[model samples]
Structures are given as structure tokens and as C-alpha cells.
Target: MKTTNYDIIIIGGGMVGASLACALADSTLKIAVIEGREPPAEWPADSFDIRVSAITRASENLFRHLGAWEEMQRLRVQPYQAMEVWDATGPGHIHFEAAELGEPNLGHIIENRVITRALRQRLREHHNIDYRCPAHPKGLLPLIDRAQLQLDDGSRLQAPLMVGADGAHSWLRQQAGIAVAERHYGQTAVVTTVQTEKHHQDTAWQRFLPSGPLAFLPLPGGRSSIVWSTTAEQAEHLLALDAGEFMAELGEAFAHRLGAITALGPRGAFPLKGRHAKQYVKPQLALVGDAAHTIHPLAGQGVNLGLADVEALAAVVLDAHRARRPIGALKTLRRYERARRGDNLLMLDAMGAFKSLFSNDTPGLRELRNLGLDLADHAGPVKNLIVARAMGLDALPAASLATS
Candidate 1:
């Protein structure tokens, strides 16, 4: 079969994949991004996507570096100046303020569609990248020095390096014989947009219930995006409620913190699971973004972690090129894996710990966690560190020794 060759072909052109392409747009290498779906051309102001991300400042910096942040801002993004967290069943609670850190805002809450749209637009201007959207994968063939992808159109594409940014159920990773360890959290995240009786004051609020954590993220026009995690069955029940009933239950659940939820826009629920690939790379095949690791969304750091992966992978690839080494070689790919896996694993573990500690109502553990929260809140330096760590501001820790 005839094959079109390039230096790199990335599968899945979501935020992370597209960001990688943008990162290398000015480089000498030819790159191609094949996405299975096309992003929407416009996001109507009156409607909000249920799937939104709490974008860390680090991710904002990344997009700024790639020249995409300004374009995203033009579309509409809500920068939250503060965050409030409290346990619904206990006295554990704390608040984080960007003012304390001398920063304008803690982060922005943006629709996933907005991010993908901004990235797709940026991809159009990059001369080095070939954007192939609405494309489907047919098969894969791994060779000695390169990997090949069979497209649905019966055409094959070859690249010295093929990356899987295709997400949690990555076809490329499976085709490359990479294994993943997965743990289903048995919880579903129900998301929707709501209008409250009072203004949010540009603050993000999170309340921990026994079922899971629920976040009320600030948005424009005194609206908020609600991400309520709960048992799957309960999630289904919540989705089935009429708007008025849903708003009633929701307002009560949040203790009417923002006052009554007067209106609800739309609702969606997604299953929660944590997955870690057994390996991030092998030979000429590699993985990034959700293909490498997926975490619980309680902390709203999922995309931030994925973007960090993009940064590390891009740096590794460029450094390999500078050293005149094959970018897809095992040694070169391992460097990228080594630079990322530990930090990702640490975060995954932390999220799991949070879920375990907060999801239980055991008297002893409850007291322990509440005490810890109170201590962390009162301890200025420690609270700052925790906030910094969640913001992806802390230095990336060393990757595990044996894993990659």
C-alpha cells in the first residue's frame, strides 16, 4: 500500500494533541494530526457546554506561549479570583485566594469546547502541521524504525514517531500493545449550568458530600457550572428530575450557599475512573495526555496534567533532535516517560486519597480529616503550598526509577 510519510503523526487532536502540534509548528519536522471529530466553529453565548475544565494558571501560560490564550480570551473565559472548599458533613473547610498570592486570579473555568475550538484555530496557522479532522483509524502497523497508521480511507500514513493522545480508551496505545491499569470510582459526574439568586463574586465553590464532591464554578452573568459527583444510580436519578425539581434539590445540596438555583441550562453525566498506562512509549510509538494517565476530576486538574505532558513530550522530542538522536528511539522516548510518569502517578494517588478520605463518614477518619483540614487552613505556609501544588505551581517531581 502507498504510504504518506512524515516525521510525526499524532492521533487525537484534542487540546493536548493540538497543543503538541502547535508547540512544534516552527520546528523543521513535518507533523500531522488526525482527529476523529471536528470541533464546532462557534460557541453561542447564551448556551454553555456541560463539559468544562477548571484551567490552571499553568495551562493559561502554556496557551499564552502557543499564541492561543488571546484567541481563547476573545471567545469568552471566566477567570475566578478565589476558591471555597468545605465538607458538607463535617467542619473541614478552607479557601484559596489569588489576592493572597499577589495574582489576579486563581484560574479560569472554560468550556472544553472553547479550548478545543481555540486549539483547532491555532492549528490552522501552523505551517508544519497537517490537520486531518473527521478522520477515523482503521489499523496500525509497527515497524523497525517507524510506525504506520491505516486510515479509514485505505490510505496508510508513516511517521518515525506516532503518539496516542486519543484519550482514556486510546486505540493507538492498545494497537501498540501498551497495557493500562484502571480503577472505576463507581461515581458519575453530573454537570450542568445554573443561575443563582446571588452573584458568585467570581469564586469557585466546592462542597464535599459523602457520595462525592460537587463544584460550583463561577461563570459570566452570575451563572455557575455545577459538577456534582455521585453514585451512578443517584446520578441517573438527578438527571431525570424536572428543571425546577433539579434546581430545588441542587440548591438544598449546596446549602443554598449561592442562594436558590433559579434556573438550570443542561445536564450531562460521565462515569469516573482512573487509568494509568503500563508504559508511555515503546520503540517508535509514544503516548501523551489522557493516553498516558487519567485522574479523578475532584481537584479539576485533569487538563492541567495533560498539558504538562505536552510540554514535557515536546521538550524531549526537540532535545532529541538537537542531539542528532532518533526521536522515536527507545532511549529518547524513555526520557520523556521518565520526566512525566512520577508526577502523574503522584497526582493520581493524591486524588485517590482525597476520594477515600472524603467519601467516608467513619467517626475516627472524619475527625482526622477535619482536623487535618483545619490544621492546613490555619497553617499559612502549608496552605499556600497545598494551593500551589494543586495549581501545578510546584516543581515537577522526579519520575519513578523503574516504571518507564
Candidate 2:
């Protein structure tokens, strides 16, 4: 038996990859993170990135466990106490509140860069984890017991375990011959910041329309981060609209929910593509985060799901370490795959169903979904169940419970 310079080599150093590195910081494992891009810089108070995520309680706990939560808080975070959801075509509306669950808050709206920056900052003090930036794989070689990675810089590294935390178009997943199921929703999400005439009241607002769903995520200073999912054609046109016209159309789409839209900020659009790798592990290689699965952003659960992947993978690896098993063996990695694959698939299917149900303008579906929403609102148990699930405090349904 031989010990490599690194116990594990992880590719991708964004939020999820960085998270995995941070999670392993306290361990004795010698890990190296290979990333092609430069690390995120510290952000100023008033500056917010175009990308943000609704960090769930589960993810928050993971960040806390890794000691990155404090830096994130000190930099920026907006804790929303309530969530308001409704159908735009009709009167179907339901709400989730933190008080109902006896929790202090549902979650926080955090900038994506801020999180990566914090993770990178935390990695600075971790002597065991090496952060390699402006680097990528030129080649990968999987041996009988270990893997060799050749970087673009003509450098070589070997490890007993390798992880692909690289996002949607994962190079490592492809190299491992993993299959993926990808579905394009035929919609693009247009994201931007806006000012409402009325205060956000620390609540997240969303309205499902025939085109897609529109979310008004509360930010600081009465501003809200809006994610409008709509057809590609409409998304192009919407992005073309000047600030004034765009603001007008936004208010109309939202029906002036928080009064009129007073101002608009930078806007960008991304095609909504749902993806899931057929297998999370192959021999000494494993996949995590977006590399394994990507969900609809309507619920702002994409990043949350990725962070959860980090947490689960980290736990499985640590447990394997305690058992003195090769961390990347199929036997060791399958535990993580089994723990996460089902939950990830469930969320993907649920979001796809919601996309189909709410995007249809059929008279029957319109009435049926609206009625369902109202009924769900009045059903305390059902509503509580939903809130619990959204807060990530609910337990995963066991096979017995699910089958029954």
C-alpha cells in the first residue's frame, strides 16, 4: 500500500467544491481542490452580485459547522421570515411563515459570490486543504487503486479519491463515463434587482404565471431579487426592454403585488436546464453538487441542493475514514449516492410537475391548481408539512413510509 501526496483531489472550487474543502478542513486528510477560475474577491457592503441563493436551514447549519457562516453574516445576508406564493392567472395563494414552525426564520437570501468568498477565506487557514486556482485537468487516468490527474499546466497529481464538484457540464463526470438526463424547460430565467413602492416586509414573494414563475426574493434596502422564468423569446424581448419599460412590464406581471416597481437593476438570463447524472460514483471517482443533479430554480433550491450534497458527501467520506476504507471505493461512495440520489430526484420531479401544472393555461388546470392552493392553505397539517419541507427540517421519507 502507498500513500499519495493528497488523500483526495476535488475539481471545481465554486460554492459546492469550496464547501467540500472547508468541510474536510478539520480532518487529517490531505486534499487538493483544482479550479480553473480565480477566487472570488471580498465584496463591498452596497455591492451585490447578480446571482443569489435562498440558503435553507440545512445549508446554513452546514456552513456553520464549517465556520464559514460568520464571515457570510458579517459580509451580507438577509433573513426572510415569511414566504408568499400565489398563482398569477387566478386567486390561488398560500403562505409559509417561520412563526408557524416555531422557528426564528425560514432562511436567508445570500449572494453566491459572497458564499464562495467566505469558503475561500475559510480555506486560507486550513493547512491540510490546498486551493489551486487558474488550473484545470488536461487528462485523467483511473488506475486499479488510485487516480492520476494531469493539469493543463503540465503538472501531475495522484490521490486515492477524486470528486467532481464541477457544475452542470461536468468534465470529470464525462471522463468517468457517467450518463446524465437533461431536460430543457424551454424557458429562461431573467434575473435582476428591483425596488418596490412598498417595503418587502422580509417576505419572499412568488407568483406562477402561464409563461413561468416569478419570484421576488427580499434583499436589503427594500430591494428584491427577481427571478422571472419565461419563454426564450419573451426572455430575449424582456432583456431588451429599457429600464423604464422593463419596470412597467414587471409591475404589470406582478400585478403591483408590492405596490409599483419603482426602479430596476442589472438584468441577465440563463436557460433553465434540469440535469441529473445517471450514476454518482464510478470506481475511485465520485460526483457531487450540480455535477450529480440540478433542479429547477423556481423554489431557489438549486444551490441549497448543492450545499446539501457537500454536507452529505463530507459526512460519508469522514465515516469511511473512521472505518479505514478507501474513500473512493464504490462501496464507500455508494453510501453517499444512496443517501442523496433519491432526494435529488424527488425535487427534480416535483419541480418538473410544478412547471407543467402552473405553466398550463387550460381552464381545468387553472381551476384545479388554484383550488388546490387554497385548500392547501387552509389545511394546517398539509401547510405545516410543506413549510417543514421547505425549511429543510423535515426527515427524508423512508422506503417503508413512501411505499405505504
State which candidate has the highest lDDT. 1
C-alpha lDDT of residue 378 in model 1? 89
> TM-score of the candidate numbered 1?
0.96
Model 1 over residues 25-139: C-alpha lDDT tens digits? 6678899999999877875678888888998878888888888999889887999989899988788889889999888898899988889999999999988898998887899
Q: Residue 307, candidate 2: how far off, in angstroms? A: 1.9
TM-score of each predicted structure versus truth: 0.96, 0.95
Cα deviation in Å at residue 184, candidate 1? 2.1
The local lDDT score (0 to 100) that residue 252 gets in candidate 1 is 84
Against the reference, the lDDT scores of all candidates come to 0.87, 0.86
Question: What TM-score does candidate 2 get on C-alpha atoms?
Answer: 0.95
How far off is residue 122 in model 1, in Å? 0.9
Candidate 2, residues 176-239, lDDT tens digits: the string is 8899999888999999988889999999999998999999999888889999999999999999
